[model samples]
Target: MLTSDTDAYYSPGHVAQVVAQTVERSRLKSVIDSHCGRGALLDAVEKSFPKIHCAGIDLDGNAISHLRKIRPHWTLVRGDSLAWTAWERIHRKLGGSVDVAVLNPPFSMGQVKGVNIELEGRVLRGSLAMAHVITTIYHSNPTRVVAVLPESTMFSEMDRQGRAELERLYDVEVVAQFKSSTFRGARANSLLVGMTRRKRQRAASSVEKAHYMSLHNAIVRGGLPCFEAVSLRHGVPFVHSTDIKDLVRGEAKESLRTVRPFTRGIVNGHMILLPRVGVPNKANIGAWFTEDDVQLSDCVIALQYRSERIAHAAAVNLRRDYEALASLYRGTGARYVTVGRLSEWLTNARNTRTYAQL
Candidate 1:
């Protein structure tokens, strides 16, 4: 059976070769593959740089034992790379010089097992792969770091905090984005990101300042939570995904309701709303607000734009490329779009055209 190693796909020989190629350009003496799986990466590094110090860490005992038997010279330790003890064992051996760090971490594992990250005094529910990247950079302080991560890590609103922290700490850029075909049986896309740690903090990506970056707060869950308690006829106007035929071109036609939310209060000023939970459709995928406020339902997503013009530009952009949004919906059933997917799309869209075009 062609299957991934639970939440992650083990790097194939060819994939390992690509990683080796990336590492070859850098002048480094020691290398570490935090999630080394079957050791394809370390093997490739050793082959390319014969005398380079190599260390591999994995949580799989069988894989580690097998690699140790085959390559007795390597320091293959079986432990979770996210934990400090694993590095301690490696430190006892390699003297803790992590010049180059390469990884293919478990993807989306946090969705099932859950991941809570506390960074700069804010709590984030990001992915496992994201956590791996952040912790690796912090602990190893590697001059060069390369890893395979999902696109959402860089573009998703849910992961914005982690990405900001990483970009804040390193000079990050995408080295390569691999199609699904790159991995034998892997269904999702992945990217090979190369990052160099910065001694001083630098400015973040423009996408970080773009209008869509703030959409994370607007992607609400199904229950509606604190907002659902208010009556539809008493507080603020309520809008559902099915209420509108298509997204409003600029500002929505007035339709008021009385729903009030205790948890998040009310949203006033220019707001752009999208369908948060539904089978993606060009028609039902968009909406917005100006001046007046409404209590958005579970099906709708809300993004507050700094001004009416930016909100109008956003609406125009959505209408122009709404078809692309339809393709982003993912799930076995009841497919839906995420703030990350939309934000990623916005970032790419912004890149393709000039600011004035929007």
Candidate 2:
């Protein structure tokens, strides 16, 4: 039910709350919302802290006009947030640096033509415009930046390259995820992620500290046990989750794949761990590994459960590690479910001809 006609759309109130929290924690002096559709978040900031100087920018002239009527004193600019050249010029004119920048940019979709291709052919792809906007703003020396984005930005392996590039330039500190329903009519789950310049290690450090605190609280309240009881050890290369395909076909050593190395210093017992690679939300996509897969060095193990009996057994056997892993999964929802049953389902489905290939 919640939607915006502006180019920089208005996010849900929860997103505004997260932005407010980030700003308060950073003790920022100035604030700007790059894609400030309708200025809902900017209004929230103004109402809560009247003295803070806030600005809103949007390409839509009508949206800017409406915002000006609502907050006559606040500065609102009409411009494209993604235009790096224009942004650089504006930054120089605005006395160099800003304290915080928040945004909810358009999720553009389209195709491009290239050489060595047919005239009618096109490749499907997600837009990098919004990501580029954030990157550009960060380069402008903003101390803190927060944006509301689709969950795919965090979970999809398809965007790994872009995500890695962004991470290299700016440290992504916290990701507070919410379901699609939380946004009323949004198509995908949304997340409020905070980014800061790598040069400001203090800001990154504080954000990380807050992230752990929030994660711990969610784990404690989500009915999941803490991970302190379960044991974690480095998995063997050959037997790692990635190498499962190789090991199953008799292409690798089975001895190297066992849990021996992981349980070496601690008490010997069975534990549930996930493969280091592959997508995180395997349950939603029904993608997983089987017993016959090859073992790769990137694999790691944690406590797992399928039926209630299995969960109980795993909990009892690896009480410490189970709690630790569960804490990690608390706020993440089904994206972090145990790998045992899901892996079996994925392997079986992959083996079946009727199932569509990923």
Per-candidate clash tally: 6, 26
Q: What is the TM-score of each candidate against the true structure?
A: 0.70, 0.52
Candidate 1 lDDT over residue span 244-304, tens digit each: 4533643344554456553232455555666676654555434355456555566666655
List per-prediction Cα lDDT, in the order shown: 0.65, 0.46
- The per-prediction CA RMSD against the true structure, in angstroms, equals 6.1, 14.3
Candidate 1's displacement at residue 84, Å, is: 1.8
Clashes in candidate 1: how many?
6
Model 2, span 1-358: residue lDDT tens: 0124333446667667766766553344567777787887776666566677777667788988988887887767777655555466556546566777776666543342111111114322233433544444654567667777655454332343344444544667545655556654445555677877677344435553443222210100011112222322443323344443443244534344333232111111122334333432222211122333222232333222223343334333333333433444322433344332222222233322321121
Error at 344, model 2, angstroms: 18
TM-score of 1: 0.70
How accurate locally is residue 321 in candidate 2, as Cα lDDT from 0 to 100? Answer: 35
